[model samples]
Target: MGSVEESPEEFTVLVTGFAPFKSEYPVNPSWEIASRLPEYLPRKDSSSSTLPRVRIVVYPEPVRVNYQTVRKLIPTLWGPNDPKINPPPGDTDAGRSFVPPAKIDLLLHIGMAGPRLHYALERVGRRDGYNLRDVDDQLLGDTAADRADPNWVWYGVPAALESDLDLDDVLQRWRAHSTDRDGVNHDLRISVDAGRYLCDFIYTSSLAHLWKQGARRRVAFLHVPAAATPERVAVGQGLVVELVRSLVETEWAARQQAGTDNKTDAKESAAAHVPADGADTVTGKWYRD
Candidate 1:
């Protein structure tokens, strides 16, 4: 009888988007794009069959554009327990709890970039230098005082943290996969600054959480134009799907290379211990014995 072959593992991604910043922008494009994502990533082509199944689990509600709200919510999203965000009023699933996947392999946070025409993948999450007030008219606190305070949320955390995913490799894959699709030219690039707004605050909080846990910072922040038009939302959604695919592909390739290197090192180590004549020098016996 022939042995059975196991299917590839499924990669689970947790996505979140912030609520509207102010009355001027009634609709936040970030949540619009994130909420519209399909449960599973759409296949690019038949050749992608070998890639692991990608499951996208978007947070149930739009995260409030408040500093305190995000600070309290980061742990709930990344911790072992199920998410604790309350469902928005009139939600159909209000009675039943919305439980995300048991294990989340990646986190993607989306935010609005006011007046910007292009999309940007943030490279760094800054812990200090936040001066903007949240929608609720709250500040993260004086940067100097917060750093000096022992009980502050970011007291001991690093001033900046970057994602563990390789941005250069992911960008290359993203450009290749998202090129000229639907005859729409998408502008995507990596940015070192996240504007020190709630976007940066949330990004820093997520990265710091993982840092404290001694875990890989598999987190990404995407800043998209504030346009909430149906056309813009659709385009944003497409870009997000491709970005997720790029991330998964890059990580998969890296793991494969690491495994190959380990095998080669093992072979070289074994060969070194064996004498040139294939005899064990310590026992004067054949290596096969």
Candidate 2:
């Protein structure tokens, strides 16, 4: 535990889990859902104060291997990303020494199957709409969306990636593990085939590290089951810490509403690319909702 450096306001979320290739009492459920995610998080400070920091960096279980061996399996939880932790530097205004040389945005990848989950925990087959063309393949798609079905996949934040927190006060603080609305996981339903293996090798290799290694930071993949008894693996590890905090607060409120609609379409395309007195004020507001 030495190289601890990261900041971009404080981030990192690469949780992963999966190892018993075919089970035999090896404690699975995606390492109890990446050991319950929550190193710290408060946000709000720009003098607006409330701060708290330590955004998140819960590791353990990307087993069938390779995330550049994730800094050789947790290099003090990896780092590199800190645009001066909001004015944090030289000495110590301290957002933990504003380091962040790599922020480490996202990479979920959880696992556990028994009823029917195929497509890439190295079983191959879910190419394009999120990868798995290898690792043994298996995600033939179509497993029925319906989690109220607003949307399910498509990321981009830096692979891509936030905070205030609300939405039904955060889905009633964990819709009881989508256990069909709290019957205590209604006997754990099983049938998730998203494909490629470690949940499609952590969502098609973190979107192949942003369309393939350019990894700018967002990545995902999840699958869970096997707790009918065995004392319900601590009720499936308290509903996998409320489904990994509702999948990181539903992707941090869709990347803060797509970064406020791309900064209101880049300030109306820089005021329609400059004009007013110089000759360029053309207007055409055509929003249809």
Candidate 3:
């Protein structure tokens, strides 16, 4: 590979947040963080870069996190390898690979979810004026649920990615927003199924796409607390910066390795396809009927 190619090139990272879950003002910290990812991963200059560098995308929060919807939207956002079926590239440089490299690619999922199950984070990580009561009101409004409305939101995505699967190699380590307290991992209640919620849909959808393409890097989803105050939002934003930096660095490194390996494999495969110098046609090369 050329020296230029070796340098960190513009890879794509998709950062997403959600809209109102049911009907709420949305103090969603994950959404808050997702909304500001572009700001967190800023360029050298003061202004924002107008390129498809590191993309920050936000998906609408459906009333219910339908599994089929997840199946639909993943392909919807990132689109399929076949250009004809998917929506047009939003940016001019979207499909075009970066030259000198505009940015590193990342796919992030962040959202505010209720703890309905065992793997729920005890701390909602909310500042003043924010509490279960408030978030409850926001989500449930006047509706009442006794002890049993499924509120446990599991985004053990961090855990899910690390595990090895037979279908495709996974993107294990991802950069994510940093927290002031290193209290996330320990006593960590881990759960695999985030239910059939939108989060699950998005996560599974992304994984399916990357896996199908044999994409080297993996997708990570972050579930944040519903921030109540502006201060908490600021804190959330800081964490987002940390997460973005961490995930981007990890992904960039992984992608570089993947690209290298892919090229090496291609070369080897090409050799197999090539025939003797005097031969006119061979295997795997283009053939006209």
The residue-by-residue lDDT of candidate 1 on 1-289, one tens digit each, is: 1111223488888898988977888999999999999988888887578678888888777888888778877876676353444422212352124455557778999999997888888877887777888988888775687777987767788877778776666777787788845655577777767888999888989999888877878889999999999998998999999898988887767667769786421112222332222111334421111
User: Which pairs of residues have clashing backbones in candidate 1?
Assistant: none
Q: How does residue 161 of candidate 3 score in lDDT?
A: 31
Q: Give per-residue CA lDDT, model 2, range 1-289, as digits (tens).
A: 2234566675455565655555363566566545555565433225313222435554432354332232122222232333322322111132223332355655555676655422111212132343333233443342344223445332232212111122223343345434543565333221223443445434444443345234333444545664434455555555555544554555555566669787421112221322212121124521101
Q: Which candidate leads in lDDT?
A: 1
Q: What is the C-alpha lDDT of each candidate?
A: 0.75, 0.40, 0.40
Clashes of 2: 43
Model 2 has an lDDT value of: 0.40
Q: Which scores higher on lDDT, 1 or 2?
A: 1
Give the TM-score (vs. native) of candidate 2.
Answer: 0.26
Which regions of candidate 3 deviate over 4 angstroms? 1-8, 23-27, 39-69, 86-104, 115-193, 255-289
lDDT measured at residue 83 in model 2 versus the true structure, 0 to 100: 34
Weakest lDDT window of 10 consecutive positions for candidate 2:
157-166
Ranked by lDDT, the better of candidates 1 and 3 is 1
Candidate 3 lDDT score relative to the true structure: 0.40
Q: What's the candidate order when arranged by decreasing TM-score?
A: 1, 3, 2
